[model samples]
Target chain A: MKSEYLSEYDNIVRTMQLYIDGCKQGKSELMRPAFHPNASFFGYAGEQLAIGTQFLFDWIDKNGPAPNIEPRIVSVDILDSIAVVRLEVAEWSGKLAGSGVRMSDLFTLLKTPGGWKIIQKAFHWHAAEQRLAA
Target chain B: MPERNTPQKTLESWKQIAAYLDRSERTVRRWEATEGLPVHRHEHERQDTVFAYRHEIEAWSRLRTASPNPSSVDGADTDNLPAPTPIVNKYLVEHDAITRTMHRYIAGARAGDSDLMRSAFHPSATISGYCLGVEYTGSVEHVFQWIDENGPAPNINPRFARIEIIESIAVVHLEVQHWSGKLAGANARASDVFTLLKRNGEWKITHKLFHWHDQ
Candidate 1:
């Protein structure tokens, strides 16, 4: 009998670490298992549509996962195969070397064939003083 | 003799399964074929189709609570996975339910489901943002008003939003960032906890309180 909980917990951490490594390496293959083959990237990527894994891979190739961006887990809840993660992606405007956005990302992920993948992702970022002025 | 006409509420009777999973017949079939969504097994029937037991369906729904939180860098269940004080479990259950509703609401906004967006929260839902030295508070209706005034949900910034639920009660800490058109304005981000009481057997958000991180 499991007193608290087991399994999946380690798998998720491994997956998040994988994502970070993938982002750092700019290797789309690294991200392959973290997202559904049909996974879509929300938010913006210039004037084009940011849908599908190709866009994410390409974005990683171009931008490099926001330099100096670090993730901190605030809390998480897991029940069965569905889980939600709350975290703060702490970073300063100067770190990114451009328009700065500080704060965290709240996300929901589900266990999948390859491993744990993000099904839905939401973020709360701070606007840079310079960009706000512009 | 059981009430046969009451439709067994049994799992995997095509019609029943589709409704239970909130999926279309075609989608359900496809998922069954590929996603390993546990096929139904009707005793003594079927050589071509598969089915699930009612008990298993209920089992899966109950399993959602133990699902792993995959985004944590450490990827463990609260390390302690405290069983005692998770009195918080009630809060957790409610949080999960409402967040799902919120996700559907945001997604529907892309589909032009105005009714969904409007009805997602209680009519009295409210938002408050604090930053620098200023504090702002407004009704949940005002948030929608600003959304309408701006544009669609996707056009808004992905950052500056967090939704947390604790049992039948939940809270959404968020900021509205409209980048274009008239709604292209930024709303300071703050935490707003909503008390979603089980009213008449249905979870309904009654009162919502907002606060600043510093306070």
Candidate 2:
């Protein structure tokens, strides 16, 4: 990677860490900085397609903490003022104890005047058998 | 605004304008709505009618053809097309380059040849997602390895859902069905999101995130 890209990559990762940290603590406030004010979310929560960022924040508050959840940065692709990051999260505790949830998240971010902020998040909830295998 | 040294003939009604442009009234109406076709409306007590100047319509047609995706214009005349401006040309070139790169990736998947796909991706590209309830992560090389082991998927059908470009950055949404591999016997489908970047005037896939639909 070019020297400029290296710095941009680090900055993007730093922003992503905020999201991971928020998930670990189960606090939407901690994750707010990573996302734009009007950021939207799309994903399947079981059979229903969950929409809007508010739903995500509310879900985080309800789910509580998952200290054991492990998040991995799979990839970060940057182009000029836009970027996309793929994240994999495993071992996330569900409402019932011993029930784990695995998630695959794709984030689209823009280099706003303020900084890099996630503008959209699309994710998929892996099946339970996949979580158990992991 | 009307230009000098051009025909000042006024085309009355949508039908006349369509006839002048050699297009259907519906198509001309759509062009007015989406492409800013120059049309003047007369407000009358009974009904309002539209009119267009021949010169203005001709100028609009030339500008439309000079846009990045002129192929989208239905039944466009190929002769005597105006040269696109530098900015528009740049966008058109980049769009074509990105599309070719995507085709290479698809070709590689169909033939199960990692080498064919290697050129489509950056050296540091990564792939991550789940297949059959299994999490796969790490370098893009892992995908090549998996493809090699699984052999060819000549029967897989891929449809490009969307391609959004913002300067040097782009995102592609693709849906594939009848993908042959570990899930060959079963009808497997997947939705893939690929992020691309233009480096040194070349577009390459930098990241891929996918979701395999549950059977």
The candidate scoring highest on DockQ is 2
For candidate 2 chain B, which ten residues in a row score worst on lDDT? B77-86
Per-residue lDDT, model 2, residue A60, is 82
Model 1 spans with C-alpha error above 4 angstroms: A1-6, A44-53, A65-67, A92-103, A125-130, B1-162, B165-215
| Top candidate (TM-score) | 2
Scanning candidate 1 chain B in windows of ten residues, the lowest lDDT window is B77-86
Q: How well is each residue in B13-74 modelled by candidate 1, as lDDT tens digits?
A: 66667666655565554333322344544223112234566565544445344434343333
DockQ values per model: 0.02, 0.03
C-alpha DockQ for predicted model 2: 0.03
Count clashes in each candidate, considering only residues at least 3 apart in sequence or on different chains: 31, 0
Full-model lDDT for every candidate: 0.45, 0.69
Give every candidate's TM-score on chain A: 0.68, 0.89
Measured with C-alpha atoms, the lDDT of residue A26 in candidate 1 is: 52
